[model samples]
Target: MKVAIEGCCHNKLEEIYKALEHIESVENIKIDLLLICGDFQAIRNTEDFKSLSVPAKYRTLGSFYKYYTGELKAPYPTLFIGGNHEVISYLWELYHGGWVCENIYFLGYAGVVNFGGLRIGGMSGIYNHWNYNVGHFETLPYNESTVRSAYHTRKYDVYKLAQIRQPLDIFLSHDWPTGITNFGNVNKLLKTKPFFGPDIATGKLGSIACDELLFKLKPKYWFSAHLHVKFSAVVYHDERTTSYSESKEMSSTSVENPDEINIDFDEELNNPDEINIDLKDGVNQEEKNKESNNEKTLQDYIIEDDKKEQIPCTKFLALDKCLPDRDFLQIIDFPEANGKFEFSYDEEWLAITKATQEYLTLSSNAKPLPPDNEIQKKIEEELRWVQENISQIEAGLVIPNNFQPTAPAYGQQQTFILQQPFKNPQTEDFTKLLKIQNKINPEGQSPIRQD
Candidate 1:
């Protein structure tokens, strides 16, 4: 299966599809799935602009509204995460993730799904320490603070992602993992964006939460955007780094175990008002960090499964934002797992969601999550429930094609304010399938609770 990876879409659906079409027409190769790193502004109508956190000049309706209204359709099966610049109010409606439009899927604030037999996971939004430990407290009719905080990466999502013990084929994040520069070509990257020198030197360039997930998930491929330069690096998870418990630290307010290695965030980053800055150079650069004593390429240290099958080292790539002549898209083919594959809900991820939904908070207060043993028990129970109740259904694990629009499309004039979140039927149906509470909307009801 050939999949296309695009970085920082900036609401360029039409341009992206056109580029893909040109690739297919010229190379005569078909692309199966389109995975966008972030900045996919899924703005539906003019009302969504109210929650967007960009400068007034930067806020303009892009091509997504056409796709939303079914005037245009996506050429390939697409999945995207959120970034700092997004229709926050619209995205918050389907916080657990749903079809932003037919053929185009939002991966939620953070989510995992199965596509073509590959287990793909993604965490949306750029990381900020001030909001990292807080809950999903931001609501509809957002204020100045909530507008921005609504898109900030939260600990709840990261903790759920951290619970995944299964091996991942691929992982996506909007920001590069902190300390990722250490493994990549720092000198060359600094030469290009010397402005990053201070942050890089102080170990503050990327996301610490992402850094934790990288070592824990240990996916074969990791893709990111946000800093908007095309960069490549390979991370080897040897005995020294694979032990995640030893490499990460947790504060009193954190969700992880307290015994982990300390990854300190600079107190200066706590400023909630700092504007997001991007490097628009769009230059392509390669960063490779090998062991100083004895270099080891990806081939040297293939991770072995219980059956001794080799899994390659994690290959990390961060692409540039979509622009003319920018290195924003790349295509790669994965060997067929089955004759063909369709979109399906990941069982383990579903179990994790079910296990953790009760802890979902709409307050700014930081709370400790359940301990490892308790969480493992809940997951096991939920996993069994999912197998019997969901996976055993006639249609099985395949996702249903039941997308329906809940909001007005662009150019559709309206008199009333969209002050409250729309109770999307897709999300309602999804939560029903899992028998978990739909915590996305305040008024959302769960089948379990209903019963």
Candidate 2:
């Protein structure tokens, strides 16, 4: 079957739209199905997760249906599996059943589907952080909130999958199985320095349970994304047996013979090389056939004129920009300055609230008491004296001219001559700041900060 399996879409609506458009433009062959592994959107809004509510933001499945019908003109059937981001929606449906489109099937936690003779099994949802709270998983004494939450939740999902049946033709998961390459990229990018000499190698950021299952089942094809890096491989399995004997007496020995196994199972285990088709022969045959079939089909002939003048395909538009701009931004509302405000609030709520209240009670008596009306009037007059002094100090203060403060140019000699230092910051430092400043101030400098 000619099926198009999309990667983690992450709400790149434009790229997805273009992909669908290209699929529509294909002339002769029919597309059997379209498989979206997971992460269709970056986040599921309350309405998106609601049993059947449709929001105006076009985030829910209803919006997806609308967009597909309006723009994509999608002819073939589509299948969707949940990713970490879509877990909430999937769970909501699990708790309160919802309608899945006639053409679409919502493959929740674990399910199998048959598509064109291919048996596809999928697992979704990330690790369960509640495991830590429930005392099912132990947490390190100095565990970071973010890491703990992520790892705890993910591990739970992997553990749950252990009870599931194996031996499927294909396995689809959002997170790459642990031990696979590229799984460490997240920790690397986040600069999560290892603590207490712990092995960061084990923090591969993939599902360990998934890895075990893959090793045991060794499905024909396994596809996963979460790492966001491109990786492909073939796994092989080999089985070996050894004979042993148990003796109860000097002359009496019993041989424990295992069942006679077909050794060919090891040889037939699907390895990576099997999928690598040598295209040289196919290419030559296709070229020869093309010449013989120069007389185009009816549909091809009809679209030939339109194809010549058709606008350039939009699929080539750089998808990198769309990922963070159209996708990440749509869901993750990144706060300014390392999310200082949010972090501060979280710290207060999670760690400091009780202590802060205790401190407030202890310091309550130290706070100055309000003056009576007559005393307040006298204090107000005295405060005017302080205000006048403060204003006079402020007026007399010569604020340095921050505007274009000069600095020594490159390769300039440093001297004690005390000439005004040219304010040319180091090129690399300035460039880094400019990048960050440019993102914050998209339209160059503001008048207030320009100086």
Candidate 3:
């Protein structure tokens, strides 16, 4: 169960793979998977660069094109969440989560997937108060404001995570969980990015929703990025009836009735095991009521359920973005969970995926109906294939300067690939994004690979 954690990739896929290889050789341990926090910049083609919302000076085709064009393959299984900087349209296509390329998985906006007996769950994007409650209205041909709002974390995703009953072994967020600054070295951070002093000092540096879930689920490990610095902290939440966080020096030893325990943790969590709000039915009436009443804040949805059994504390780490020798990555291992675990497709995600797929088939005036037997079976097959492959994704050195066949040989399972043809000119600008990626390398001098 060896795994590697990476912070913001910013499309430096080659550097990440190289670093992992170096770690493997030095530590004499093979890393099984590489989990990236965000800003992965899956710009597979020149056309995708046009879709990016970053300033013209910052836009460039990143490492994604190598894999997209089949000139290079991923060296290890890669899993990533979305951050503020991403191609919104492409991710929206598989909003319920899918394989971006062979052995690389995108967790969508919010999702839960099991890997080798480890239940990893997380929500993508940073939180913005203005866009927190808004539906995803940012479509293609994105306008300036819409483009900026595209990556804002929404309440809908947070609500979905709030409904889960199973415990998450690892939780990932693109931004640090709020109140986490209390756990790390703020003075050291201030020395690096002095502007963050106020936010860190005031406990306003990261997402409030992330902090809420951290308390509720209490996952064993919580990983984040977007800050471009590495910081580590431990959250100690022992089994107790009262709501408290160890980082804040709040005690968790007081006992209270479990029935009233959940209601005390913000809004009424109710019976988590029994509260099933049907996705197709749309937003729950309870949620709607809360929303209409005085413009419900993000804090309104931060509910923690009363646990019948105790869960352990979560170790939080926010790694630096991918760069050479900056301590932006780590290699670690975990014990495999006991008993049978479903490695693919949570029941809730399947419902959302099925619902979205069915909605696409109907005309504007038509009422959408669930797909029939044949269609249902096909969906099931696809989900299982993605799940099983991701659960056992391979890690090996990649072949350079090779290409995939347009058509597979007879009886071979079709490799899922996005067809994106673009003219690649061997010019200075092609390596612009590959150049020193800002402040971490203010001198604009990251070493180029020999490839």
Candidate 4:
């Protein structure tokens, strides 16, 4: 189906939707879904602003408040991943990922969601080697130095995606994959932003973990933001199949023998709400045929499933941030699986989350990241746990209780705060909302255990 893709939102929801609506009206085409890359500053209230990791100059309400106040609503269902410039204290609450509102979904720090039978995988935050293997322990009330820790992409999440043998239709990240410079018109890109050349030459442009995933996962399409300039590339995955991975460290993070790759497809995706693909009213029959044939599991499409062919090349697009007259937004078409594919947590991924618990998930006000040695040791331990227990977890014999699943940051649970919100948000009201979130939660639950 035709989907609208935006680069970095920076909380320009109203403008983006307005543009989407205008395009729909003009083209007479019904956009099925809206996918945002990152830098989605979901600053609903002032407390959210405080928790955001952006510099003071860049931290201001764009248009999300109107959506929060019910003054406006997105014209279509929206799905987005997290980025470096975000109110991560709020996102930290939804660690497993959930709907931000009725039609808005966050794809978690690193997650896979099925939309219209399309397996869309995403990695949140930019990758920095210093914080790459560090545990996801950075929490709320972050000081200047500590805030950067919140956006550092962790290896634990990447490890989960790494376990998937099935190919992903699309992948999203806040930053461009490091080697993307090689696939695209890097020389022309330098004309727009010359300073980027130094980083590109030194292989320091984007995330190293992301680069590894691009080569390893071999997704059909990879979309990103952060470098706010429109760029496109086609990565030939099959060209150098053996050398796809340059890093021995990332290549070694495989959970092969321990995982029962042949998971029961029956119980795989029972979560209807997560992957329901309802077609819009006005879509044409021709459009249906063009966009309906999605590649789900290795077995979902039997056309050529028997052979293990080298995966197809990946199309990479990194769009510019949301601003007036930015030539970054684009519309693209992708196939949807003809048959209903189950939408559920990937078995290995679920196992990793359950087994590793807080090591992969940083709770609000949790401890800071451990030192490098401790980080490496913990990662080794987590990997071992996944390798040993993945099969049991897949078979329903093991489920870890240490994980306190994250709560939804929006949706019905948060309607009270949005009830007739003041158009011009006052500090007192924002404070009250903050108190409701942190202190007197009507949900009768707190993220932290009461001593």
Provide the TM-score for each candidate, comma-separated: 0.84, 0.40, 0.63, 0.66
C-alpha lDDT score of every prediction, in listed order: 0.75, 0.34, 0.58, 0.60
Worst 10-residue lDDT window for candidate 3 reads 255-264
Per-residue alpha-carbon lDDT of model 2 for 286-373, expressed as tens digits? 2234446757776774584364334221000000111321211110111221311100011111111111112111111322222234
TM-score of 3: 0.63
Q: lDDT: which is higher, 2 or 4?
A: 4
Q: List residue ranges in candidate 4 displaced over 4 A.
A: 239-311, 335-352, 355-451
Task: For residues 1-451, write the lDDT of model 3, one tens digit per residue.
Answer: 7778888777778767877787677667777778999888777544455456666666756667667545688888778999877877566544555556666778878888776677788888888767666666665466788777778887666755754556788899987777675544556666876777666555556777787778877888888888776677666575441222334543212111122111111122122111121112222233345567776555655532233123355678777665544556876677574423223545434433432333331111323333345445555564564455432354211111112222122123234232331111111121222221111112222222122
Candidate 3 residue runs with Cα over 4 Å from true position: 239-311, 337-343, 348-451
Backbone clash numbers for all candidates listed: 4, 11, 0, 4
Return whichever of 2 and 4 wins on TM-score. 4
Candidate 1 Cα deviation (angstroms), residue 256: 26
> Which model, 1 or 3, shows the larger TM-score?
1
The candidates, ranked best first by TM-score, are 1, 4, 3, 2
Where is model 2 more than 4 Å wrong at Cα?
12-14, 20-28, 42-46, 49-74, 87-91, 95-99, 128-166, 182-200, 240-451
| Residue 389 displacement in candidate 2 (angstroms) | 92
Judged by whole-model lDDT over C-alpha atoms, candidate 3 comes out at 0.58
Q: lDDT per residue, candidate 1, 1-451, as tens digits?
A: 8888888888878877887887787778888999999889888777888888776667778789899878899989999999777888778777888888898888888889888888899999877888988998887778788888888899999999999989898899988887677566677777867778776655567777888899888998899988867777766675654422245443212222121111121212121111122222221122222233265555554532221234246778888766665577888778754434567888999999999988888898867899878998999999999999988897777878877776677666555357667777888889898888777775733211110
